[model samples]
Target: MKLNVLYFAWVRERIGVASETVETDAGSINELLDELSAREERYAIAFSDRSVLRCAIDQTLVPFETSLANATEVAFFPPMTGG
Candidate 1:
């Protein structure tokens, strides 16, 4: 499936792009991350610390184990602070 993946804040900085369309066969968000992490050194660096990452599928926040079935968008970012 093709997914429109979004990166926010430092994720964008490290990956050198804010967003991109990715063709993936990942069944879940965690698997997707693993796929991207293997793409290049920059991707590995951007997603190095999974603990600091938060994800949302199609705008609604979801856990990494969430399935990607029928999902067209996925976003990754750091946890938000109280501000």
Candidate 2:
């Protein structure tokens, strides 16, 4: 499956990219994250702490266990806060 992956805030800085197209056989968001983290140290650092991260699948918020079937986009970012 081909997925458009987006990184935000510090995640982008850590990964050194804002977005990229990823091709993977990962069945779930966790699996996809694992695949990315295994690719290099930068990815590993970016995803090192999953607790503070939020994810959206096709612009809809989803859990880490969410299935990636037919999903075209996945975005990862830190929790949003407003003052």
lDDT of each: 0.98, 0.96
lDDT of 2 by residue, 15-58 (tens): 99999999999999999999999999999988989999999999
Of candidate 1, the 10-residue stretch with the lowest lDDT total is 46-55
Query: How many backbone clashes can be found in candidate 1?
Result: 0
List where candidate 2 sits over 4 angstroms from the true fold: none
Error of 2 at 34 (Å): 0.4
TM-score of each: 0.98, 0.98
Error of 2 at 64 (Å): 0.3
